[model samples]
Structures are given as structure tokens and as C-alpha cells.
Target: MQDALAAHPVWVIVVDYILGAIMWTLIGRAAMNIFLPEDSNFFFMRFFVRATDPVLRLFRPITPGFLIDFLVPIYVAWFFFMIRFYLMPWLLGYSVMGMLSFPLESEIAALLYQAFNR
Candidate 1:
């Protein structure tokens, strides 16, 4: 595990962290939309809208028109997920596709394992 962590430059980890955050945030926004309007004044909803609006807009051209407005976040999130899962590993010169490219998730899982096993 340490070797794997050490093999990548620090920027790779930082990129993973950022992309993971955006992916999760978009997912969260989709989930929240089930109960709240897009214009809702709730803090988390507001934060989600504010944070993910730019990403959604950036993807607007590629986003299918058939997808209803509520599903747009999930669709955008899928792009980020793919970029992290596939593109990042390729960038790091991994021969295998679908390698464990999610450093942020890896660290969290490791911490949880330590806490529960202790």
C-alpha cells in the first residue's frame, strides 16, 4: 500500500481528492433534489447548487436534452467519476484500466479499517 502511495506524485493525489469531492457533491445534490427545490434556501442545497452549477454548465453541451433537469447532476457526476477512475490512472501510466485511482477514498477506507479493527 505504501509503495502504491509513493509511486504517484503528490499532485495526482490532490487531483483525485478534488475530483472525488466534486463527484460526491454532485451525487449529494441529486439526492437532495428529491426533497427540495433547486431554489431552496436550505444551506446544504444552496451550497450544492452554488458549488456544482459551474460544473453542470460546463457539461451542458454534452448533457443529453432528454435527461430531465433533476437528473443533470447525476449525469455530470458520472463524467467526473469516469475521469477519476479511468483518466487519472492512465495519466499515472498504469497498464491496467480501472486501477485504484481514488486516493481520497483509499485513505478514508484505511482509516475506517484501523478504527474498527482496533
Candidate 2:
């Protein structure tokens, strides 16, 4: 219990974890873009394409576009938000933005939770 409590507020750990996720996401988008244009260097493209596909697949049907469409980075940001909010706050303590966003995301997450929870 003491160890866990002590570990909660480390900013360096949190930032690194989130940044790692973002890099993976960027690599994935780059791979997809490479494939879309033409079939080239399948060996290298396969790794990045695979790494990011799970998340990208979620929004794949929607065509990419300007700001709203450029969700690659946004998804990374939101994923980190969820981890920091719902998962980490218990350790680090109350996060103002997390507390505020909970109700809003709950409305969103719960719908999916209900649909898939069973």
C-alpha cells in the first residue's frame, strides 16, 4: 500500500508512457498512408501498419480529412486522457479535468460498455 501511494504522482513516468503510445500511433498512420498510395516495401510497412491498425480500424470507414478527420494524434491524446483520468487518478489523486470529463465520457463509455459488457 505504501509503495503504491508513493508511485502515484510521478510526472516523468506518466509522460513517457503517453508519449510511447503516441509514437506507436504515428508509426501506424504512416504505414497506412504508405500502403494506400502503392504497394512498396511491404516488409517494413507491415510492422507499423499492424501496430496501429487496431485503433485506426475503429475509425477506418470514415475518410481522412482536415482537422476533425486528422484523428490520429487526437486519438493518442484521448487515450492518454482516459488512462490518466479513469486509471491513474486513484493513485495520483484527483485530477480536475478528469473529474470534470468523467460524466461526459461516462455517457459515452457506458453506452459502449452496455453494448459490449455482456
Candidate 3:
């Protein structure tokens, strides 16, 4: 019974990886908002920056603390993906999503809804 419960972390890694994707997604949008004139005020883009800025702050040093640098978010997304897809499932025996079933389900539902809504 106790050993059976150990697999939970694999799921957590998967979800965390997805979040890492989101973090990068926001970073991409933030870059566009700063550069491209048209998408500058996209509400969701603003929201992403606001949402991820705090967490990414810890990783900012990887980018040398430069707001304009693309390296931080890009690398972060990559790192998370590696952890989620390769490391977690293959090495840990599950996925981050498997661990975070609750939020992942809602997030997936929301994504599906958004995708189909368009």
C-alpha cells in the first residue's frame, strides 16, 4: 500500500512540466508584447506575465536578470519539458499530470473549451 502511493510524484512532474510550458508561453507573449505593436496589450498576455513573473524571478539569474533576454523562458520551458516527458515518465514511472490529476483535468478541460470555442 505504501509503495503503491510512491508513484504519485511521477504525475506531479508531468503537471509541473506543463506549467513550465505555460511559463515559457507567457514569456513568449511578453516578448511579443514588448516588441510587436499589435499584440502589446493582449489581455491574456498581460495576465501571463503577471502570473509568471514572480515564479520566473528565481530563474531570472539564468538570463542574467535582463528582461529582454529570451534565454530564460526558452530554457525554462525546455527544462520542464525534459523533466515532464522524458525524465518523469521514463525514469519516475508516471507523469506530472498523473500526480496533479485535479488541476490538470480542469486545465485540460479549459484548454479544450478554449480550443473548440474558436
Using lDDT as the yardstick, the better of models 1 and 2 is: 1
> Over the stretch 1-118, how does candidate 3's per-residue lDDT look in tens digits?
1222353555664565466567557557547656554334777666666666665676666655554444555656566555555665566454444443433444566678889999
| 1-118: candidate 1 lDDT, tens digit per residue | 4644696787777788899999999999999999999999999999999999999999999999999999999999999988887777777788544444467777777789999998
Runs in model 1 lying further than 4 Å from the true structure: 1-4, 97-101
Rank the candidate models, highest TM-score first. 1, 3, 2
lDDT value for candidate 3? Answer: 0.56
RMSD of each: 2.1, 14.6, 7.4
lDDT (tens digit, per residue) of candidate 2 on 9-97 = 45634453554465545545554664453244665555555665565666555535554433564555455565656565555455544
Provide the overall lDDT of each model, using Cα atoms, as 2-decimal numbers.
Answer: 0.86, 0.51, 0.56
The local distance difference test score of model 2 is: 0.51
Displacement of residue 72 (Cα, Å) in model 2 is 4.0
Q: What is the lDDT of residue 63 in candidate 2?
A: 34
In model 3, which runs have C-alpha deviations exceeding 4 angstroms?
Answer: 1-24, 27-31, 34-40, 64-68, 94-118
TM-score of 2: 0.35
| Top lDDT hit | 1
Give candidate 2 misplaced runs (Cα > 4 Å). Answer: 1-6, 9-23, 27-39, 59-77, 85-87, 90-92, 96-118
Error of 2 at 10 (Å): 12
